[model samples]
Target: MDLREYSVFDIMGPVMIGPSSSHTAGAARLAKIARQIAGDDVKEVQFILYDSFANTYKGHGTDKALVAGIIGIDPDDERLSHSFELAKEQNISFSFVKSDKDASHPNTVRMVIKNKSGDVIEVLGSSIGGGNVVLKEINGMSVEFTGEYETLITKHIDKPGIIAMVTKVLSEHMINIAFMRVYRQLKGDMAIMVIESDQTIPEDVRIRIEHIDGIEKAIVVDSINKA
Candidate 1:
């Protein structure tokens, strides 16, 4: 076999120090992205790793890397060397579970997060390759994003004119949304909107969004470059 002709995976194969950069590093990045989506002041986090991730998470540092990432640590940070202990020091509660499901990518992970105010969020993501990731779902919404944008994620009851209301608020603040995606469950009763913007949303706008009717929760995630 011409190793050079093959993708990096073919050359490197499965790794143990980490489950190839695509899985472990990508998992770390996904965790970081989830934290970004959850915003700061996070208190508790639950991680669900699927398929191959479940089989070798420990050896790959997927567990440690994940906890470390959630705490706002970089994947390559040596502090990850003691992430389990560091997480304890930081008082960031974290746990992990393994699941067998065809619903998610083989390298997928789902994050259930809670902030200090008790606001809860659930995000699903996948580690694609080359330490890159795509946020595949949020709050049960099937969406595709690179997880790098400064974003606002809102969960609410689906109703008429909610998008207009939210967008109007953002527009009034001069925040330009680069893209918007919505996910709704069962006749649009419960919904989630993921808004990617060119820049961060102001605190005042965020506060205003919280007051919007039908909005259950609003979270502002700074870009990973900023985090």
Candidate 2:
């Protein structure tokens, strides 16, 4: 098997807070995604760890890493060690659960997050050996995207022409779609769309997507090219 050229940081080292990149950095990234999926102010959080993460998280500062992220700390910052006190200051309650079942990846975490509005969302992510992470699922739907690009997430009624409507708007705005994935439990039910693009998605595009006839909710989950 041939190994593709990986990132230089992954090869040498990731200038991060904790000792383990997979547990600490990956856990923090999941928190940033939690903010993206839930909102900035998280009221409650539950992290489910499987495989290696379940056994050694406490020693690696993984728990603190997760708490730091949920409370708005940057993953690379050194303050990740004090995440517990910070989370207490923020009044955000968090819990951890170790899973006995096997996961596709060795370092996987599933989070159940709730926002200030009492809206709860489930996010599944995996730390792929580097400081890099991949968001694998949302709620129960399958999705795959790394936060390296601008991403758009929409929850809509599963029906015809919605894709056309959304993409048309992006096309009009000259946004280049790098990757896209759609997940739905069944036909004619709730659907979720994840579209990663090469440019910053404007607020207008997100609003427009929500306005489409079949769309129920729309939001941009992008971090690239932000001021």
For model 1, the superposed segments whose C-alpha errors exceed 4 Å read 1-20, 36-39, 114-120
1-227 per-residue lDDT for model 1 (tens digits): 64556567546743323546876677777888788677766789999888877878888888888887788777556776588898888898999999877645677788999988898878898877767678877766776777567878888898898899999999988999999998887676888888989988888898899789999888787665454
Pairs that collide in candidate 2 are none
- Candidate 2 runs further than 4 Å off: 1-13, 224-227
Q: What would the TM-score be for candidate 2 when compared with the true structure?
A: 0.90
- Per-residue lDDT tens digits for candidate 2, residues 13-111, read 656786877788878877777677775768999999999889998998888988887787777887889989888888889999999999989888888
Per-candidate RMSD, Å = 5.4, 2.2
Q: How good is model 1 by TM-score?
A: 0.79
As for candidate 1, its clashing pairs are: none
lDDT of 1 at 19: 41
